[model samples]
Target: MTDDGFMGPPWQMDWTPKAQAVRDTLPEHVRKTVDAVRAELVTAKDPYFRGVDTDADLPDGMKVRPIQSSVPKGPRIFFFGHGHGWLRHTFVRRVEDPQIVVEEVFWQ
Candidate 1:
């Protein structure tokens, strides 16, 4: 936990260009939804592993093979821990120092 006493993920997370690009295209309402999800991650005690659904498909041409987990939320805007309604696919990883790096975002 930081000085704010919030219990977030074992690592901090941030948006990659991919995620940001998707966010930039969303409507204000949808963006708010994605924003809320991100805020939750910031305060979540296990953001990396929380709310992860392995059945979700990545943006790659591959189908949903139950081999990956994504953080899809709020009508599917598609973020790392974001995605509201207009975004598509995203990847995230935890760094050695306990930080989650949002790798990329993709569309179908």
Candidate 2:
């Protein structure tokens, strides 16, 4: 949440419950990948390797159909892990430079 401006829609970190019951509800791969993504996201700034798409731009009308994720008009990305039933989901698309306008789009 730096002066980097609105990096996209407001998002919250993992809200998974600490309860054992909820822990065992999702598929094994989902849980494992979630942890994997979590571990990477915890250190997204490292260049050696990276997790999650923090700096990537989201194109208009784009949808993550190949994976178990959703990208509403709010323009953000979501975890491909277990679907959070009713938990609030957020979309974020990075917008670079407030200046330099042009006629075409640049998918940086």
Candidate 3:
């Protein structure tokens, strides 16, 4: 149980985890390419991050940022957690063909 008092896992767990879906959705060749992308990421000093990931072979409107917190700084990719309300149904984390930009970095 969490402080919000719900008796369940922190995440809904209704959908497959994002990275697996990306691998499953691609053709074998594409999957291999994705694997290579991942291979270059895994265990590397460079960071991997994403905001709102999806099961596809393209950018997820993600802000691929350089993590200069340490050496070999590069894009950091990690999946986004679900948005609280309607966003989950309306959004699947695919980078829109027309990119979305967030001008301000807001942290509470």
Candidate 4:
């Protein structure tokens, strides 16, 4: 295993149709930020990299903190993005697949 105890390869990433649509509608700057975040997430060796439990408050500023659902098992559902500007994207990481699927994108 690697230093982080992660075995196998890094997680792949994909975006749902809805999430892609939302991303397409984002302003240039926000879209760039989202792209950067996606790049970082895909390179993560651990599935829970930088993730926080959903119950916890989000971090301040442009930092990205994945918010994991409280469910004890099954596919992981989480979101990460700019906590302050409300640019959030929800994702699902299935147990069977080494992929991070972006489910929804929202900004306000």
Best by lDDT: 4
Model 3 segments beyond 4 Å from truth? 1-16, 48-108
RMSD of each: 9.3, 13.6, 15.8, 5.3
Best by TM-score: 4
Can you tell me which runs of candidate 2 are displaced by over 4 Å? 1-23, 46-76, 81-108
| Weakest lDDT window of 10 consecutive positions for candidate 4 | 53-62
**C-alpha lDDT of all candidate models, in order:** 0.42, 0.31, 0.30, 0.55
- Can you give the TM-score per candidate against the true fold? 0.45, 0.30, 0.30, 0.59
Instruction: Summarize candidate 4's per-residue lDDT along 1-108 as a digit string, tens digits.
Output: 456444434667778888889889999987876776676556655545444543233233334444544633334333345342333443354444556777677766
Candidate 4 Cα misplacement greater than 4 A, ranges: 1-9, 50-69, 72-97
What tens digits encode model 2's per-residue C-alpha lDDT throughout 87-108?
A: 1222223454211111111111
Which lDDT tens digits does candidate 3 get at residues 2-94? 354423221211223554554466566555544443333332221233333322333332223323536222323322212111111111122
Which residue pairs in candidate 1 have backbone atoms (N, alpha carbon, C) closer than 3 angstroms, thus clashing? 11-98, 77-84, 77-85, 77-87, 78-83, 79-83
Clashing pairs in 2: 76-91, 76-92
lDDT of 3 at 72: 27
By TM-score: ranked, best first: 4, 1, 3, 2
Task: Name the TM-score of candidate 1.
Answer: 0.45
- lDDT leaderboard ranking: 4, 1, 2, 3
Clashing pairs in 3: 48-76, 48-77, 49-76, 49-77, 49-78, 50-77, 50-78, 60-95, 61-95
Q: Backbone clashes per model, in order?
A: 6, 2, 9, 0
Supply candidate 2's per-residue lDDT for 1. 41
